[model samples]
Target: MKTELVQTFGSRFERSLIEEIADIGTWMEVPAGETLMDIGNYIRQIPLLISGVIKVLREDEDSDELLLYYLEQGETCSVTMSCCLGQSKSEIRAVTETDATIVMVPVQKMEEWMAKYKGWRSYILESYHHRLNELLHTVDNIAFKNLDERLMEYLKKKSEISEDNNIRNTHQEIAVDLHTSRVVVSRLLKRLEKMKKLQLHRNYIQILDL
Candidate 1:
């Protein structure tokens, strides 16, 4: 476990911090599409991603979901940190985008490490700053971009994160993530197909223009 931690985050974090994580953190291999955290759930552990991608989402009262951003290799969710410190339920949802190997650090150790390790404190603060910028970008897309423009951005980001031009998400799934109606997504997709931006198939979409 320590070997894995060292390989993933050895240089980024201090030697002592890595040792502590290996000692206390529960290593997990979570599969794709699994919901690791959800709205209103009390977070017990903070995930330190070793490989693969985890997408963070936000939901409304009616269960409509909007894609916020992604947690990639060597990254942790700052929103999870906030919930851990506040001792409150999670405000966002975290789902595995691919088969993911992660170390689940117990929330209890956060404060101790913050005061003990200067490196740990710096890393946490940097993570918060990174996530804040992503959240702001999401807001800008919603407020400034048209629906079609937003859809393009979403499609590009999906391809980048999935590392594939062939997107497997269904129309309804895309609609949910975009916080729009399925009909709207379908209509726009058809237009994009005709424009040679993408090629649609049953249950999959082949993006021509990223």
Candidate 2:
């Protein structure tokens, strides 16, 4: 795990900082579909993804979750940073989109590193900026785009992140992510099929084109 972290970010950080991370970070493996964090919970550790993908979501009072963005290999969760900095409870959720390996650093170390390491500070700021932009894009899609367009955008994003156009998700699952009904998703998906943008199977969607 130390070697992996060094390989990932060693060039940007000092050897002493990397050594400290290795000593303090604990490796963890998370299976697909598992919830890594939940709303209103306090985060005690911050994870640096080593492999696979994690999806960050925001849930409403009714427990409807909307997909915010994905954290992939070599990325960290920005929301966790916010929680650590403020010592507040999480307002979002993080679920493993695929089987993932991560290194968890104690929350106290996160703050300490931010003050002690220039590289760590830059990484945190970059993570926050990236996540904020992603959330803003999500908001724009929801506020200005129709359901069909949003659904298409969501599918495209999933395909891009997963590095596969064959999306193995049901209409109901898609609806849940988009915060809509299955019927609506099915209807738009059918339209997409008719337009030859994608092909629908029983349990998956295959993109034929954009």
**For every candidate structure, what is the RMSD over all alpha carbons to the true structure, in angstroms?**
1.2, 1.2
Pull out the clashing pairs in model 2. Answer: none
- Model 2 spans with C-alpha error above 4 angstroms: none
Please give the range of 10 consecutive residues that has the lowest summed lDDT in model 2. Answer: 5-14
Against the reference, the lDDT scores of all candidates come to: 0.91, 0.89
| Model 2, span 1-210: residue lDDT tens | 778988877877778888987898888889999999899899999999988899988888899988888999878998888888899999989999999998888998887888999998898888899988988998899999999889888889889888899999888899989999999999999999999989999878998876
User: Residue 158's C-alpha lDDT in candidate 2?
Assistant: 88
What's the TM-score of every candidate structure?
0.95, 0.96
lDDT tens per residue, model 1, 6-96: 8888777899899889888898999999999999999999999999999999999898899999999889999999999999999999999
TM-score, cand. 1 vs. native: 0.95
Best by lDDT: 1
Residue pairs with clashing backbones, model 1: none
lDDT of 1 at 7: 86
Instruction: Give the lowest summed-lDDT range of ten residues in model 1.
Output: 4-13
